[model samples]
Target chain A: GESVGLHLPTLSVQEGDNSIINCAYSNSASDYFIWYKQESGKGPQFIIDIRSNMDKRQGQRVTVLLNKTVKHLSLQIAATQPGDSAVYFCAETRMSGGGADGLTFGKGTHLIIQP
Target chain B: DAMVIQNPRYQVTQFGKPVTLSCSQTLNHNVMYWYQQKSSQAPKLLFHYYDKDFNNEADTPDNFQSRRPNTSFCFLDIRSPGLGDAAMYLCATSRGGLAGPRGFFGPGTRLTVL
Candidate 1:
């Protein structure tokens, strides 16, 4: 069965420090991966994504690393801020026919930022 | 700015009652999706409408239905609500397949079953 899982359920970091969230996927055929942040009452917000061909992709203050060989993905947040406190989720894109497909999300990791 | 929009941020329905959650996107995306999320859990894909085609996940219950009358609007209908069905429903839109294009999500609607 294809599934995505997180290494940790919760992570705590001080402001200005870096935070890393890890995820492992079972589907070797999955080619695209994404990281999302969800606030207390909001939907998941896109943070960053990485394709299988690319090992790493960087966004503002955030980076996504994908290891296809091990089927592992990680999201690194640099200089963590209080606003970064949220549940982080990793998703694998499943491609079906000729069109885009739905995403399979992993159990989220709660990131807590302390001042 | 163009974005995905969901109406009635909160909803309460009685058990066995029918309810519908609505979503609209101003981005004019070709693909629209509905996801269910419980407490401390990840969003689970329920169904989606690509253009005019409706695709449902295998695990999705027959009690759940969807309608995409046009490109900008999509709806999720629960034929009969259950206590276990209480969860946050999120709507998202994408211009292309999930592999390449970025998807935009709405704030989500919280459903309460009484």
Candidate 2:
């Protein structure tokens, strides 16, 4: 909650290199974690998600790792491209009463792709 | 094919004036949410509508109100805009339940308070 309107930390990676963005969530009760890529002037786009039962999940070019023990989540981007330049947010949610709950987001990391 | 569309990608309103932002989803998601995102910051959920049930975040300002007349469309109204209210307003939808699908977000509307 302290992250409101705060300047995001940045991670700069050379183009075609792999980039890893890390987030440390606050709630241990959070069971669902997601990574979102938000380009300038656009809304947040869902990248990859992993549930608590599994420690790892892979998407097309992205992989999400969850560590419930440390309440940590990370996103690994392979062959980072210029288009991949954006702000990355790691969000956690607690599913209760079998329904949707609001997501609590991290301060976020701005991933910059260098030529 | 556009799944979720938000009108007036850029909106300019005078302070103390009432303005409304709109969102419609073709994904037919059961839950729709409105979020306020400031520059270079994470989004904060204002409220959400699960089907016909309206749920407002406790901290959401009383000036902010939402209406989900039907399943596909939702509206966010600001009674009196202030300079601090200027930010990107995002509309998101999800298939809510035990399965809890990832939310689909629309191209946010950037509101500029004059």
Candidate 3:
């Protein structure tokens, strides 16, 4: 992934309603993508992941959709709650950047769950 | 339960002093990563160790370093802490390099430079 500036976009949703966070990745060859949720004063927690071979993967109330054709990814959360308010980041790993290195993260999207 | 643990949940160090943050995992994963995140910023990869092999990010400053003595332990060493270096240090581990489940992250060590 190409280096990006520090600014990030934000999405606000009402509590008990569904929320959708979107991301646009730079690398088309990225084969693996993961979504992470980082709450206040905590490390980024893994939410879900999707491989390039597949278009969508679901886990619990979270679903990751990958659109390789547009080099885009989105995470949909069901029944957003106050606990879901946090910074969400999407990371991508490609076979090209070297061998099995760590992921390259996006600028992140702040998910605000409003009551 | 399988989880990642980080020691010294809070650290305070004087400018130019050396500081180390520790991380350990019970999942027995082979890969470990260290990241630095400022307030409201994305976690930036500083470096990682695949077993004993150390891989550093190209843009990572010379002031930062890391060590993974074994499969479950990894450490981040700041040779000379600066005010700008003060941030939350996160440690993560994964079962495999790629095509693996979401990597597990430690609770993070919040570092404050005096």
- Of the candidates shown, which would achieve the greatest TM-score relative to the real structure? 1
In model 1, the runs with Cα more than 4 Å from the true position are: B97-101
Candidate 2 CAPRI classification by DockQ: medium
Give candidate 2 regions above 4 Å deviation: A1-8
lDDT of 1 by residue, B13-101 (tens): 99999999999999988999999999888999998888998889999999999999989899999999999999999999887754354
Taking chain B only, the TM-score of every model is 0.96, 0.97, 0.95
User: What's the DockQ of model 1?
Assistant: 0.62
Q: 2 or 3: which has the higher DockQ?
A: 2
- Tell how far residue A34 is off in model 3, in angstroms: 0.5
TM-score of 3: 0.92
Clashing pairs in 3: none
On residues A54-109, what C-alpha lDDT tens digit does candidate 1 reach at each position?
A: 99999999999998888999999999999999999999985544345888999999
**lDDT score for candidate 2 against the true structure:** 0.87
Q: Give the TM-score of candidate 1.
A: 0.97
Clashes of each: 1, 0, 0
lDDT of 2 by residue, B56-75 (tens): 98899999999999999999
Tell me the deviation in Å of residue B23 in model 3: 0.7
Task: Report per-candidate TM-score of chain A alone.
Answer: 0.96, 0.91, 0.89
Model 2 / residue B98 / CA error / Å:
2.7
